[model samples]
Target: MKLSTNYLGTVYQFSTLKEVLAKANEEKSGDRLAGIAAETVQERIAAKEVLSNIMLGDIRENPLLNPEEDEVSRIIEGQVNERIYQSIKNWSVSELREYILHDDTTGEDLKRLSIGLNSEMIAAVAKIMSNLDLVHAANKIEILTKCNITIGQKGTLASRLQPNHPTDNVEGMIASLKEGLAYGIGDAVIGINPVDDSVESVKRLLHATHDFIQEWQIPSQNCVLAHVTAQMKAIKQGAPADMIFQSIAGTEAANRSFGITASMLEEANQLAKVHGTGTGPQRLYFETGQGSELSAEAHFGIDQMTLEARNYGFARFFDPFIVNTVVGFIGPEYLYNSKQVIRAGLEDHFMGKMHNIPMGVDICYTNHIKADQNDIEDLGVLLTAAGVNFIIATPMGDDCMLNYQSMSYHDVATLRQTLNKKPAPLFEEWLEKMGIFENGKLSKIAGDPTIFTR
Candidate 1:
């Protein structure tokens, strides 16, 4: 099966409502920064403005748009929203009532809490779903999500699925799935961990993961982050990490991850279509780096294989699609007042925005081991120094950050906090630098400006 889900067609997307009024009658929205009012006291007003700000945009830049990438075509991307009742469509109706009312600080008794959905948001999402030819594909577009059982702390998403749920979360499994179905989620992404670079284990794990996907009520896909452990180590040691990755003399685990990854692709052909999203060739993402990024030869080889597989393409094997990345947000592992070194991985890699084919960043934690505030800030500084782009977060912008999901909002907050601490960037002015009317053409407002400042 060629994993060809690129944006061959159009998709619908828009800006947050606040952007509209500022731009209405061509009123100056000033800069992206000027939009923040310091506090969101009247949310209802935000909804009405959303309608005005909501306009047609292309899927090529929208990460949620089905991309040619098998992974993108099948995964759901977005920070959660409870500001609107309509956000209900994003979750199953029954499930919404379950956690809809719980305060972000309550900390426990998940089932008993009521976490409300942003009704207006759901309405908007529903309207989008309805227009996607729901009548024809609703039945075929099975929606579902799978969580990684491994996670930070005992009270986080990863913890909830602990014990037997080590591979996937069981506590919210049903509800998450129901939400997907409600919002027309096509599939919940189940990512393969420890892509041990082994031929045998990779093959087995692929089979196991694919099987897991098939069992779900909705169509599903598997995600594997191309983690270059050796590269990472090398970068830290300031030595050649790619050599360790490519010339692995005794790294059996690395071999297993690659092997399983390859097998997963091969197995997709034999398995029922339900498990994976595409049919011909699968697209694979290779991380970027020199001391760590796969050598040109390694990347070339993978690209050649993908091309030989039917031209479905390989990421990092060539110029990447404008969108597509591995990124994540991390909350403080512990509440310490200390700080450490932080690094931004890439310039293009960013969070807080979606593009056709699940664009953004693929990320994993490095100093997540109970670093102090100063340490975390240092980490951000390091990432900024390193040029990392995306950072995940909780839905409502809470203190837990992305790790614990305690009312977190915008993984990009890392960038904001990082920038705020270091240099006084004219973020709003900078955001305006790109989107002003360039000749007769208007550049689309993209990800938050902070994602790129590093």
Candidate 2:
């Protein structure tokens, strides 16, 4: 048949459908390749031939094409599954507790094993472990389940105020802040991606965000989502360096597209240490996602999810305050639909948590895709169950400037209620002091519809 196709910008030629199928079954083969093989074979071969082949060979149904239940079971029984089951099953309660708490190697290995298991299995394992062991394991995995960062002298769940402005206008940004703060959001940090990437524009936004926090006496941090170099300029210009932000990728070249170098990130880290808010464990704020390496043409034939995990390796170098896998923000080219998006989100979160990176997820989707708020809610709940550190709380879950829908402030409050979770410790205290929260419950202010309306 002489079928030639491109996967991640590399072209592979096969003389027949059988050769394509063989390559698709190779270890570490990408889902894209397998999808391509299936489509090509279906096109060239008769239905009976394909059905016969499927029935006779060890070829399994494409998990993506199957229903959710079957897909999950397939994953839990895959190669990484038994390794995880065996690893945890072989250890006694005390021994598992000791290894999770003190053995860094085993803790990380467990995280790797967890990549293959579903949320149900992960939760089941958590149930089996003791409270102390679970807490220590969560800490080792850098899960921000109960830890609070000191913001405004009150404890709060690490959260972000993502108020993206279309024109980088200072007034528009201030309006967004007023709205977000009015609703008891922005506990983690209030950061914006400026439409204008200029030094002066970034400096103006940074100063404005900082002044809003100070004038209102808010406990949250602020940042301008500019390049590291632009941020460096703002910092040198005396702008408040609360947290330096960047979009990092797995490969050096992919990161270069964003104008980030390892040295530059290190410099930003040092600069933040001197001039930024030292409220949290680390100062840098990084966002990554699956398939970004391939999207940037730097994947080197690696699968998107594996490439994403390698990006975490780069991110951990800076010891970031936050690392969010902006799961679906890259659009459908990389993650085609809700199923792919949800799975990628979980995989990225699980991998980051396992690596002990302070992991969060921007449960987001572009309007061009077959995804909606319901999908985000489903993935958000699952991520919460997995002890994800934080999520992007945008206004009404839609960012006009970024042109994507994300987790809204209302969504955050709903998840908290559903799971009986609260904000970061320091931020929660401030909320109570301000009467926004009463007796660990949301006060009237949190329910005021006028806040978003205004």
Number of colliding residue pairs in each model: 104, 14
Q: Give the alpha carbon lDDT tens digit for every residue of 26-88 in model 2.
A: 122133642432344333233212222231111122221122433222322343345555445
Error of 2 at 194 (Å): 0.7
Q: Best-fitting candidate, measured by lDDT? A: 2
Let me know the TM-score candidate 1 reaches against the reference structure: 0.26
lDDT of 1 by residue, 329-367 (tens): 222211111221122222122111111111222333323
Candidate 1 steric clashes: 104
RMSD (Å) of each candidate, 1 decimal: 22.8, 11.3
lDDT score for candidate 1 against the true structure: 0.24
